[model samples]
Target: MTDASDRLASVRAGLDRACRDAGRAETPLLVAISKTFDADAIRPLIAAGQRHFGENRVQEAQGKWPELLAETPEITLHLVGQLQSNKAADAVALFDVIHSVDRPSLVAALAKAQAAVGKRPVCYLQVNIGDEAQKGGCALADLPALLDQARTAGLNIVGLMCVPPADVEPAPYFALLAEHAKRLGLAGLSMGMSSDYETAALLGSTVVRVGSALFGSRA
Candidate 1:
């Protein structure tokens, strides 16, 4: 197997171990974070059986994914970054899942886009889990209202997504997101990344967006 395939296998093993350790029966969906990598870098993982892949920008995905998708039509493309209201229509038309539904305006834009395009990508409401000022998620205080607004606006919100504060034990934050998911009747928890995905899986993340661990360090 190629180096990329080996890394994919290792990550899968780690995920399986995390599931066993957590006593969780189902493994979280591993959305390979393929933001910067080119098609050549991605095909190795796909050849090894990876179906779900994530990109951070609509424009970037547009420039890179069309040809790739034509090659592999079964791939599930995810938009795992902050989305602008203006790009809502393109995002809905492109991504299979969007892990960044944050504010009311974005929520309304996405709803309108979906209505116009007739394609509703499953979404996750982003939470500022660490309460950081520079983050893109909805404030903890605003999450409930935003979620309600998104639902009322006709968006299919399936879960909560968060990027916990950097350089800290991420367990509590992951747990907090999971708790909110339960309390709010949300079924999916779109947290975790390359650094702490195993911890996230143990803490009940329904989807983990992993990048470097699978694709190797980006240039």
Candidate 2:
């Protein structure tokens, strides 16, 4: 098993190499996906200077955040999975950023929860760039209306996010997302993962949520 320091070094090296190959500036945010891993497994990564992490399930994150925060309050937690409306409140309470706001109802719920929390959790409006019905995201055409609704509801819309169809090339969809974000004047694009992150970097991804490539396959 690779020690956490080795894993951190390897992942950073990969990100740097990817950025150089893509001719893109290295993104300042690389979120190590920590879902399914225990706090003990994550602590060494934190100790090794990893401050940003992504979690998939709300319940899992709910269980992890407080303990992790106790160890490192400065850590930035990102919710990088489909967020059900019922879980919006807990998500708002837990994450520093929510990268899966795919619908207006979720947006509204997040806004309400944010109000109660007294902090506007940075939000990424998930776009179904591949138009995959099985994916959790808004239709690309509905984005403008959703943005308008988010603005009206006082939700802080920081950017857009997407999960490209697995078998297809991800660059075009990533580029499309970059274009959409530019049109909307949003600042973040939370795309890319282990497989196509280099392509995503080339196309313009501000944040890449990497899991297996960093931590190896989960047990």
Give the candidate number with the greatest lDDT: 1
| lDDT of the structure predicted as candidate 1 | 0.93
Backbone clashes in each candidate structure, one number apiece?
0, 0
C-alpha lDDT of all candidate models, in order: 0.93, 0.86
lDDT of 2 by residue, 1-219 (tens): 348778778767776777787777655378999999988878878888889999999999888779889878999999999999889888888888989888888878888888888878888999999998788899989999999998898987899999999998788899999999999999899888988776777677889888887777998
* Candidate 2 similarity to native, TM-score: 0.94
RMSD of each: 0.8, 1.6
Candidate 1, residues 26-62, lDDT tens digits: the string is: 9999999998899888888888899999999999999
The TM-score, computed over Cα atoms with residue i paired to residue i, of candidate 1 is 0.98
lDDT of 2 at 144: 97
Candidate 1 ranges beyond 4 A from true positions: none
Cα displacement (angstroms), candidate 1, residue 82, comes to: 0.6
| Candidate 1 lDDT trough over 10 residues, lowest sum | 1-10
The TM-score values for the models, in the order shown, are 0.98, 0.94
